[model samples]
Target: MRLSQAFQPTLKEIPAEAQIASHRLMLRAGLVRQTASGIYTWLPAGLRVLRRIATIVREEQDAVGGQEVLMPTLQSADLWKRSGRYDAYGPEMLRIQDRQKRELLYGPTNEEMVTDLFGSTVKSYRELPKTLYHIQWKFRDEIRPRFGVMRGREFYMKDGYSFDASYEEAGYSYFRMMLSYLRIFHRLGVKAVPMAADTGPIGGDLSHEFLVLAPTGESEVFYHHDWDLMDWGTSPLDPQKSEDLDALKEIVSKTYSATDEKHDEASWQNVPEDKRRSGRGIEVGHIFYFGTKYTEAMGVSVSGADGTAFHPHMGSYGIGVSRLVGAIIEASHDDHGIIWPDNVAPYRAAILNLRPGDESCDALCERFYQCDPEGLLYDDRSERAGVKFNDADLMGHPWQIIIGPRGAKNGMVELKRRATGERLELSVDEALAKVGLN
Candidate 1:
C-alpha cells in the first residue's frame, strides 16, 4: 500500500507511558493506540501483524488435532458459580448484572463454559477425546495495568479446551498441546521453553506455562542450561494410541523447568549449580489438566463402556494473543523498531522512492510496489531521502529497496537488509528477483 494515503502516523517523540522498546516502537510505527487504561485499538498495520501471529497459533493448533470453535466472550455467570469460582474470582473477573439483574461476566478464561458445553453435548465414551479451541476477547480488570499491551486488561486470546472420557486420555492431550506450543514459538523465530507451573486461576494437578526468554519478562524462572537443546520436532505425534501421547508427556515432564511460583528448592538443588540457569521469562502460553473439576461441577458426564455415567477429564490451554505481539517485540527488537519475523511482518519490504516524481525512479518503485502482495509499504510520500531512510528503518521491514534518479540512471537499485544493515545494489531485473514477492 502507498504511504502517501496510509494512516501510519510516525512519531518523533516516544510516549512516556511506554516503558519498553516494543511498546514505544508500536506507537511510533502506527501499530496500536491506547483506547482505555489497558485496552487498545489496533490500527490496520498493527492488526495485520496481530492476525499473522493468530494465523500461526491457529495452524499449530490444527496440526495438534484441535478443532476450532468461536466461543462467546460473555458467558453465563451461572457456569462460574457451579465451579464455586464466581465469588472467589476476585475483582479481576469483570462481573456484571444483566437487565434482569442476573449475574454475567466477560470471561477471563472459558474452562467452565467449555465444560458446560461439553456435558450438554457429549454423552458417551464413543465421542471421547476431543480438543476444541476458540480465539476471542477476554477481560481481566488488572488493578494496576501497565506495560502497554503486555499486561493489558482487555486482550485478544486463543484458548482451547480438551475433553476425554478418562484421566489418562486427558494427560496425553496436554502433552500434545505442549509440543504444539514449542513448535509455534520456534516458527515465530524464538526459543520458547515449557516450565512446570502452578495452575494459578486455571486449577489443576498438572500444568505448564510456555515462556519465551526476555530480560524484560515479569516472571522469574529456573531451567537447565541446555534447555534450548531439546528437540520437539514433527515426529508424527499421532494421538490415536494412548502411548503416543503418554510418551511425549514423559519426555517433556522429565525436563527440569519451573517458574518461581512452582519452584521447589529441594528439587532444584538436586541439579548441579552449573546446570541451573535463572532468568526472567514472559508467559506466552499456558495449559492445564483439571480432572473433572468443571465436568463434575457442571454435571458434564459421559457413559462409560460399562454404561455407567462418568465425568470426563478436561483441560484448557491458552496463548495470550495480544501479549505475544509485545512479548515477541520484547524478545526481538533492536535500536530501530520491530524486526518482525517474515511470517508476521505487516509488509515484507519497504520501497523507498527517493526521487519521487523522477521517471526512472517512479517507474521502478511502481513496478516493485505492484509486485508486492501487500508485501511492500511503498514510501512515495513527499520527503527527503534521509527522512525516508530513517522511516523505513523505523518501520522495520526486512528489505528496503531504494530507488533514486542516480541509481535508476545507472540501471541499479540499492537493496538493504533491515536486520543486518547490509546493502546490495542490483539491476532492476535483479532487484525484482531478490524482492521475492509475497
Candidate 2:
C-alpha cells in the first residue's frame, strides 16, 4: 500500500467529540469515520485491522472445536419469542416491523437463533457437545452510544453457542471457551483477565468476562498478581478432553478476580498486599453457561440413549471483534499513536522513502517492498520528513524502515521500532535481516 495512492483521510485536528485516545487516534490516522451518532464506516486501514483480528478470532475458535456458520443479522421475532426475551430485551434490542407488519429485530446476540437452527437439525445425544460460531454484525441501539466502537450501536462480533448432553459436559465446554479466549488475547498482544461476572440478560449462573487493563476503562476491577505472571502458552487445547478442560478451569477460576459489580472487599483483604492489584479494564470477551435455559424454553430437545427426550445443556461465548480494534489501541497506545502488535498490525513494516525521488532512496524502498510486498506499506508520497515520521508513528506499523538520501547513498537505512524509540542504522541487508523480512 502506497501512501500516495491510499485513501486514508487523516485529520490535522482531533474531532471535538472524540473523548478517548483510541477514538481520536483512529480518526487522525484515517482508520475510520463516523457515519452516524453511533455508527462508523471502517476505511481501508481500519478494515484491514478488523479483518486481521477476525482471522485471529476464527483461528482460535476453530482450534477449540467450533464450526463456523453464517447467521442473519436480522432475525425473526418468533425466534426471540420462543426464548421469552422478545419483550424482556428492552429498547436496546432494536425491534422493527417489516412490510407485512411482522415483528423483526437486528440481533443483539444469537443464542435464540442458534438454538433454533441447532435444535431443528441435531436430534440425538450422540451428536452432543457441538459448538457453532459466526462472525457477523450486530446492533444494540444504545441510547447514548459513545466511546467510538467501544460502545457503538453497530459493531462486528464473534459469537458462538455450545450444546452438551449434561451439565458436566457443559462445564468442560465452558472451560474450553475460556481457554480459547485467553489464547486469543495472548496472541492479540493484550493481557485480558477473566473475572466472575453476572450474566445479566444472558440468564446464566455461570459467566466470565475477559477484560483488558487500561486507565480509560469503564470499570475498576480487582485481581491477584498471579494473572499477570501466569502464561497461557501457544499449546493447543482439545475441547473433547473433559478431564483436561476441567483442570484448566479449576486453575483459572480459583484465582481472585472480580469486577466492581461483584467485588468482594473481604476477599480483597485476604490477598497479600503486594499481590493485590487493581485497575480499570475494558471488557473484550464474555462466556456463559446457561444450561438448558434456551433449549428448554424453545423446546429444543435431543433423544437420549434410552430413546427419551431432553434438552441439551448450553453455553454462549462472545468476543467483540470490532470493539477489539479500539480495545487494542486503548491497551497498547502511548502519547504518539497506536502501537499495533505484530500479529494484528495492518502492515508489519513500513518502507519510508524520505527522499522519494532520490535514486538511491527509491531503489532501496522499491527493493524492500518487492521482498515482501504484501506485508509492507510504502510511503512513496511527496511529503516532508516530519510529516512522514508522524504519519508512520500514527499508523503504528511495528517497524519503520527509514531510507533517507544520506543513508541510502551509503547503502544504509535506519530501522526504527515503533513501540520503543530505538533506531538502528544498518545496511539494507542488515535491516531486512533484523526485521526478518529477508
Candidate 3:
C-alpha cells in the first residue's frame, strides 16, 4: 500500500474527547473516526487490524469445535419476551417497532436468540454438544461511551454459544473455551489473566473474564504473580481429552485471580505477600456457563435417553473483536504510536523513501517494496524526511526499512525494529532477509 494513495488521515494533534492512550493514539494515527457520540467508522487501516484480530479469534474457536454461523443484528422481541428478559434487560437494548408495529430489538447479546434458533431445530440429545459462533456487530447503548473503541456503544464482537445435555458436559465445553482464550491472547502478544468474574446479566454461576493489564484500564484486578512466569503453550491441554481438559481446569482454579467485584480478601491473604500482584486491567473476553437459564425459560428442551424431556445446559463465550484493536494498542504501544504485533499488524513493515523522488532512493525502496508488496507499506509521498519519520513511528509497523540517498547510492538500506529501536545498516537484500521478506 502506497502512503500517497492510502486513506489514512494522520492528525498532528489528539482529538479533544480521547481520554486514554489508546483512544488518543487511535485518533492521531488515523485508525478510526467518530461518526456519533459512541459510534465510529473504522478506516482502512483500522479495518485491517480488526479483521486480523477477528481471524485469530475465529481460528481459535474453530480449533475447539466451534462452528461458525451468522446471526442477525436485529432480533425479534418475542424471543426476549419468552426468555423473561424483555422488560428486565433495561435501556441498553434498543427497542423498536417495524412497519407492522411488531416489536424488535437491536441485540445487546445473543443468548435468547441463539436459544430460540437451536430449540427450533434440534429435538434430541444427539446434537447436544454443539457450539455455534459468529463475528458481528453488537450494540449496548452505553450512557457514556468514551475511551474510543474500548467502551464504544457499537462495536464488533465474536460471541459463541454451547449446548450440552448435562452440567458436566457443559463444564467441559467451558474449560475448552478457557484454554482457547489463553492461546488466543498469547498469540496476540499479551498476557491476559483469566480471573473469576460476576456473571452480570448473563446469569451464570461460573464465569471467567480475560483481562489484559494496562495502566489505563477501568477495573482493578488481583492475581498471583506466577501468571507472569507460566508458559501457556507448554501446558498439557488437549481439547480432545476430557481428563486433560479437567486437568487444565484444575490448574486455572488453583490460581488466585479475581476482579474487584469477586475478590476475596481472605483468599488474598492466603498467598505470600511477594506473590500478590494487583493492577488495573482491560477486559477483552468473557465466558459463562448459564446451565438452563435460557433453555428453561424458553422451553428449549430435548428428549433424554430415558424418553423424558430435559433442558440442554448451555454456555456463552465472548471476545471484544473491535475493542481488542484498541486494547492491543494500550498494552503494546510506546510514546511514538501503536507497536502492532507482527501477526496482527496491517503491514509487517513500512518502506520509507527517506529521500523520495531521488532516483536511487526511489529505486531502492521500490526493490524492497516489490520483494513483499503485500506485506509492506511504501511511503512514496512528497513529504519531508521529518514528516515521514514521525508518521512511520506513529503508524508503528513492526519494522521500518529506511532508504536514504546516500545509502541507496551504495545499494544499502537501514532496517529498524519498532518495539526496540535497533538499527542495522545492510544491503537491500540483507535488509529483506532480516525482515523475512527475502
RMSD of each: 1.9, 1.2, 1.1
Model 3 — TM-score against the truth? 0.98
Model 1 TM-score (2 dp): 0.95
Q: What is the C-alpha lDDT of each candidate?
A: 0.86, 0.92, 0.91
- In model 1, residue pairs whose N, Cα or C atoms come closer than 3 Å (at least 3 residues apart or on different chains), thus clashing, are none
Q: lDDT by residue for model 2 over 1-438, one digit each (tens)?
A: 877888999888889999999999999999999999999999998999999999999998998899999999999999999899998999999888999999999999999999999988999999987999999999999999999999999999999999999998888889989988988999999999998888999998999899999998998899999999977765445555777786777776677998898899998898899999999999999999999999999999999999999999999999999999999999988888889999899899988988878898899899899998777899999999899999899999999999998998899999999999899999888999998888
* Residue pairs whose backbone atoms clash in candidate 3: none
lDDT per residue (tens digit) for residues 1-438 in model 1: 899989888898899999988789989888899999999999988898889899999999998799998989998999998999999899999988989999899999998888878777888899978899999999999999888889999999999999987776787788878778877887777778889899887788998888989998889999987677765555666645667777767766666899999998988898789888889999989989999888887777889999898988988899998988888888877887778777778898899999788998998788788886476799998899999988888878878989999988888999998777899989988877887863
- Stretches of candidate 1 off by over 4 Å are 230-247, 270-274
Q: For each candidate, give its TM-score against the true structure.
A: 0.95, 0.98, 0.98
Clashing pairs in 2: none
Model 2 clashes, total count? 0
TM-score of 2: 0.98
Candidate 1 lDDT score relative to the true structure: 0.86
lDDT by residue for model 3 (227-260), tens: 8887776776788799999898887878899999
